[model samples]
Target: MAEKAEDTGVIAWLVETVKTVFWALVIAGIFRTVLFQPFWIPSGSMKDTLLIGDFLFVNKMAYGYSYASCPSIRIARLGVDIGADDFCGFIEDREERFFGADPERGDIVVFRHPVDGRDFIKRLIGVPGDRIQMQDGLLYINDAPVQVAPVGTFDEVWERQGPLGNTPSCSNGPVGPGSICQKERFIETLPNGVSHAILNVGDRPGDNTGVFTVPEGQFFFMGDNRDNSVDSRFLQANRGVGFVERKDIVGRADRVMFSSAGRSMFAFWTWRSDRFFKALD
Candidate 1:
């Protein structure tokens, strides 16, 4: 009888352990899908605003949930004619809740790759019904030069930009040393007086040329690391696709939660002490 009681206790303990782990994962998934998700900037595509190795928290509910994913919005279960959703471009959801809003320009955002389902972070440079063109190292939005200027203090980093479709070095960024973190970077000005800094490495792609028109439900994105970033400019070869879909947007970047180095990713003990707690713009 004693042995039986002990065996029963052990089984109950295992059952409780499994239940705890299952619930923990369920709660984490809910938070990642519904509330906020944590992300780390792996490259300089976002430059000054976001840097490689910079980790941030993205708001998932800024828009709403999408039926295209999760059990709630399953097409087979919820059908196509759903109600309000937190997902972008969804325009509707399940419980009959409704809200109408769209992402605006100059907003830093995270979206799903058009080609792949992976998430990416970028700035909203072009919107629906906008004509964007580039000529003579200038950005023209609606046939006007987008205001950009080089500042003494630049957030760009110079890097080894390889050959890019006959376009030579355009992004002149930096191969920054110990200060690989985002906040250590400086600023740059776009042609339109939108004074923002992007990472510029002395690569060859800043000279990329193409005219893009953002579609109704899509948005155009570019890396702040003008020279080194492979954004909409390099879409033809990007696995994530050139344009971002509305459904991929997870949240708007509010501020930098923390920053570290590219190496800090491996040996966290090597994190630069001075690069901590610097407020993001």
Candidate 2:
């Protein structure tokens, strides 16, 4: 009789434990999907402003909830290729968002690609009905050139960076590994008086683009690393990000929660203590 009672007690404890774990996971998933989403800087396109290994959380509440607020878990090695559409696709292609608000110019925004489902981060340069152009590497809005002042050069090691092992582009030619790769840095003030650092790696094709008139309900974005970025300056048909729709906007990146200089975040010794909780300008 005592043995039977002990067995029943053990079974009850196990069942309660399972229920607790299941609820915990459900709550965490909801929190991540509707409140904040974690993002890692995977490329150097926004270099100087955002580094290759900086990690941040996108504030989903800043611009209200959209279908893009749903999380897309894509771990290639694990064969997991989920997307926002897979989770909240029924709400996609809708022009309206729940409690929607527009993103201001110069805000660092994350949004889903108009064609592909990949997420991209860039500085918002043009809102709807704005004309954007780049002439001789100078940004112009509505035929008025934005103010740019030369700052010091941005320097980094000319070596493989992050897990992708991408080589940094330098204004100075043919820089070898272990040497300083330098790019001309400047402070660009937009029409709205917002200022941010931008890098120039000599002249590139994107520097001489014709005026692009942003359509209604769409926004234009560009990377701070002007020459290397494939942004709205380029066409989406050619693998570049064209104008992004308002419904696709996920959230704003306000701060770097953590940063790792090494290839993997698990490398404790390579953690960058200085960038933790560093607010973005």
Candidate 3:
């Protein structure tokens, strides 16, 4: 009889353990899928505004819910990929958002690529019916040049950045490793009076662009790093991100939760204390 009691107790403990794990997973899935999603800055395209290795949580509720609100999980190192559409693909065909609202100009937004399902984040530059152009590295919106003032030069160590080990380009070219790489920085004020810092790394083809009229229901985005970004200035071919659709927007990035300058976040010594909980413009 004692032996039988022991077996029943063991079975009860196992069932309780399984139930606890199941509930934990269910809550976490809802939290990630409906509340906040974490993102890490993987490139220097946004430059002074957002750096590589910067980690932040995207506020999915900012513009209400859409098919893109469903998280697309992809961990390249782990070989895991579950597309956002895999969760909410059925509603995507309807092309409507649940409690949807439009994102404002100058907002830093994360959206899924219309062609590929990968996520990309950039400053929202133009909205529907707005004409955007770049003339001699200066931004022109609706035939008016936006206000841009030179603030200073943004300098950083000319070393490999992030896990990709990509090197930074300098206005003063070809600097040695551990040396300072400089990029001209400017403060640009949009029509709505939203101002942010932008970096210029000499001239490139993106410096001069013909006027692009943002299509209806679509939005335009651009990186803060002028010469290095493959944003709306490029067409959506060959892995370029063109104009993004409203339904494709995932969320707005409001703050940097944490940041590390090193390749791995676990390198505690490399944590950027200044950027912890840093708010975005």
Candidate 4:
């Protein structure tokens, strides 16, 4: 009887442990889906604004939830066929059901790439029905040149031995081995009074662009690294991200949660302590 009671106690403890773990996973999934999701910067497209190793907590609820934001779930088709379109058409139409406020200009947003459905982060530059153009690397919205002021030069040491591998020490300019590349930095103030730093690497292909009118229900995005970013300056047909639809947007990137410059996670000294908890402009 003593041995049997001991066995029963062990079984009860195991059951309770499993129950706790199961509930913990469920709660964590719900929190991640409805509130915040973590993201890591993989490229230098946003440059001085966002670095290659910056980790950010993306606010999922910032623009509300849609089918893209949720985990995959199989659901039976239940809507009546109104004879207006085919079954696939109806499914695509109802796939996106967004709530909350729309994203504003100058907001750094993470959205699904329209062509390949990959997640991408860029600053929202043009809204629906806005005319955007670039002349000599200067951004002009609605025929008005946005305020841009030269701040200073940006210089950094290029360590060819980091985990990130061959950091671009040069701005929009060319770089050579064992040399320091200095690039001009500027502050661009959007129409909404939100200002951020931008790097100018001299003239590039995207410097002079024809007028682009943002379509309705779509938004235009650009990288702060003017000459280095692909952005909306290129056409989707040409293998670049074009206008992003409203349903594609995930959320705004509010702050840098952490930053690391080392190639290995164990390299504690490569961690950027000053960038911790830095708020994004």
Best model number under lDDT = 2
Error (Å) of candidate 3 at residue 16 is: 1.4
- Between candidates 3 and 4, name the one with more favorable TM-score: 3
Candidate 4 lDDT over 97-203, as tens digits, reads 45756789999998877766557899999999999999988999999999999989877665553444746747635666657777789999999998999988877
> How badly does each model clash, as a count of residue pairs?
35, 0, 0, 2
Ranked candidates, highest lDDT first: 2, 3, 4, 1
> What Cα-based lDDT does every candidate model obtain?
0.57, 0.94, 0.93, 0.80
Q: What's the distance in Å from true for residue 83, model 3?
A: 0.9
Off by over 4 Å in 3: none
Among all windows of 10 consecutive residues in model 1, the one with the lowest summed lDDT is 160-169
Q: Is candidate 2 or candidate 3 better by lDDT?
A: 2
Candidate 4, which ten residues in sequence have the lowest lDDT sum?
80-89
| Model 2 local distance difference test score | 0.94
lDDT of 2 by residue, 1-281 (tens): 99999999999999999999999999989888888899999999999999999999999899998889999999989999899999999999789789889999999999999888899999999999999999999999999999999999999999888888888999988888899999999999999999999999997999999999999999999999998887898888999999999999999999999999889999999899999999998
If scored against the real structure, what TM-score would every candidate get? 0.71, 0.97, 0.97, 0.85
Distance from true location, Cα of 151 in model 2, Å:
0.5
CA-RMSD of model 2? 1.0
Error of 4 at 91 (Å): 7.7
The Cα RMSD in angstroms, rounded to one decimal, for candidate 1 relative to the true structure is 8.0
The CA lDDT at 201 in model 3 is 87
- Residue 178's lDDT in candidate 3: 97
